[model samples]
Target: MGVSVFSLKGKLALITGGGTGIGLGIAKTMIEAGAKVVITGRRETVLQEAVDTLGKNAHYRVNDITEKETLPAMVEDIENSIGPIDILVNNAGTHHKATAQETSDKDFERILQTNVMSVFALTRECARYMLQRKKGSVIMIGSMAGLFGIDKIVAYGTSKTALTGLVNALVTEYSKSNVRVNAIAPGWITSNMFLNAIANDPQRKQQITNRIAMDHFGQTEDIGHAAVFLSSEAAKYITGVVLPVDGGATVNF
Candidate 1:
């Protein structure tokens, strides 16, 4: 029997902030690809709803990634109770819209703590076990804001840009141990939050549409598929790369 490269048949995936949006998208796709998914979020209700939607292959865990001090024990407990996480998705993040001048120190720090520091802490905890096993994939959810100049998101952009550095640094240190670290930078995707933002400012929507080579916003499934590919054995040889899932927006003039 030829093994399928994309099949995650026996794997277990842990996704932070998996209750909604892109994280929920990833959880759904990962389940379809044959992995048992554990989706975590701060709200039990939200997580349960996601699990219910995902059906039998999905499970829910209540977690607040921002509580950095508890992350080590939390990850350990998840691994021991749920399963050895073969894939870890650092999808929990916060977005703050403000220019450098307008961004308050508190706001910047809050964004950093949620988006960057928490991701690092959780990743490190999961990696310790993966390293011992010499097998695992870690996917960081990066943003287009990190790729190019996006106004009014100074703090959010800075935090995302740091993820690229995190991927590179971790790959250098952990790739030899068979733990791959990579990132996926999503394009402007259609969601309630995005729709509201664009509805309020049509000019902003037009500007975004014009830049995308596809001339349209991407879907959540676009990101979900990318996450699955990266986490599967198909990408075993790939690591330390920042893949722009952005409809050529980063390069388009």
Candidate 2:
């Protein structure tokens, strides 16, 4: 009956891509749960807007995740300026909508650099501090493309699938230091991008709806709630798991 286990009070969370969509959703939920949240994105204007909307518990830092070499300094700056990051959400990523044959080598590498390499680089830097303190949580934003498969997303899918392996491997090492590593594989969550596309193509919308057993697309807050649980003491023993925040779409037959 005690809900304190789910509380994120006094915690500090650093979320990448927090200017919009699911990232902003996570920041909102974390702030409501009593955590001080710092969101990062490449767009200062967008980050500023999100922070302003999120009120006092929210902050923003403009940093492109693809800038791998600068991640260390960015982490240090955040630590000194804000506080030790108790939760880190690797949410910034790029998507390439193309078949394997159509996806150029350059395109694939670009996706990997943004989605995989940068995530690893930032994770390593944050893990250094967490390991030293012997406490922290790392959450990677995955996708249904990685969990199953979808057309026109070869490069993006590969990058997300790699996170599963990354989380598993990191857990073996970081768990010893109490630094948990995990990932959240989100389903077709409703967003302006998705809604606009679906509105124009009813057939495509129906196809997606039929796949979801819940008969509806997920909300951004669904993933946000899951992230909160994973970051909170409620999920202290949970790590190395790729939690599906889908509405059973991944299991549909």
Candidate 3:
């Protein structure tokens, strides 16, 4: 019998900012699904540590996606050395916490460059090869900040909102070629960063917990598992959709 549609046995996936947090989760899950995964970040040590934990099926590359000029060559190098990238996860991002009134032009622009522009640069470079093959999946890691409004994160929210638009536009241009573009908007996922944010702020933590229908935060694996399903052939017919992995937070009142 043929392999399961969900199995990613021979696929090569490249995930940006995969050395830690949500990106790391996605890398681990993709490896478990049988895909040979390549994770990229600026920190060589962190990337190597994650590769070690993810075992042999996982690999690491040190590249800063924010350097737009270098992206095309980097993609070529990865494809030449490892394999054709069947899946590209635009997961590298940064967040800024400040009101719109307090957000300087430079701050907003920096967030946009990292979260939106860099994602486009990498996706385009990878898509060039995928277009020739007439097959690939592109997954954007979005955020709850874009799903709805929360105070003090104007720049971050704006960047994430842009990703939804990016997904739709890419699918329109590439879906006919069998290349799929979609996004996963993760809610409050449990991670050291998140815990640290809420550690001393009891009120903030309580407010977040109350808003979640599940009455708790989600795990990084929640986002990872969703990414795997969307990247696999199981989701061949799905494109331009944003799957929320937010523990019902977006739906809660």
Candidate 4:
């Protein structure tokens, strides 16, 4: 091909939890693909650091997705101040490892509020703007926990599973308006989150790798590339679908 179908020139994308890890990876890739990227997180310092490192095309905002009531105004501010968001990546999510019996109400609510409630709130507000403009892509950062139940992640897994429903519902509702909604279920991505835990135990690492056909830790860039492809014109006809960037972990095991 003369140029990749993944060109995102002139597009504006908003990524949540973009100060680090997979969120930052997505922001970086989108910027390289010629999109103006705005990233938001609870830490201003970290977000700024990401913006500084990501160069002039990247912008940063400080906002906590856990604050459900504040999401509307935050989304509004981005739309008005940063320009219309042609793409929204709901990448902000938190996970707590606990069995259903051991999970407390406070912990359960926290997970639901951060992972499910905020995503819906942000998606709703962004969908409104996209509906008016009649063009947009809302990409959800789903997890393998949702695709297949994982132990000790009762609350987190529940929220991620809910994300799939959100994608399907919105896809049906907004496809008529030319707004496409999709989700990506990433396998274990190599991040500070995973690296620190697996630093010493080669056996644990091997156990993890054996589950995946790829036989390696999937990097943040892998997720970034997947997000770009799904958000770009390359996947114009794709919607209501959950694409796995999991390296066959879900299937191989």
> Which structure among the candidates has the greatest lDDT?
3
Model 1: lDDT to the true structure: 0.90
On the 0 to 100 scale, the lDDT of residue 194 in model 4 is 68
TM-score for each model: 0.97, 0.96, 0.97, 0.95
Pull out the clashing pairs in model 2: none
Off by over 4 Å in 1: 1-3
- For all candidates in order, the CA lDDT equals 0.90, 0.91, 0.92, 0.89
Tell me the alpha-carbon RMSD of every candidate. 1.3, 1.4, 1.3, 1.6
Regions more than 4 Å wrong, model 4: 1-4, 196-204
Give the distance in Å from residue 160's predicted Cα in candidate 2 to where it truly belongs. Answer: 0.9
Model 4, span 1-253: residue lDDT tens: 4466789988999999999999999999999999999999999999999999999989888899877788788879988887899999999988786679999999999999999889999999888899999999999999988998777789999999999998888877999999999999989898876686567769867877888888677889899998899888888899888889988999886
Q: Lowest lDDT 10-mer window, candidate 1?
A: 191-200
The number of clashing residue pairs in model 1 is 0
Question: Order of all candidates by lDDT, from best down to worst?
Answer: 3, 2, 1, 4
Over 43-126, each residue of candidate 2 has an lDDT whose tens digit, in order, gives 899999999999998988889989888889989999999999999999988877667899999999999999999999999999
Candidate 1 residues 22-139, lDDT tens each? 8988888889899999999899989888888999989877889999888888878878888898999999988876679999999999999999999999999999999999999999
Between candidates 3 and 4, name the one with more favorable lDDT: 3
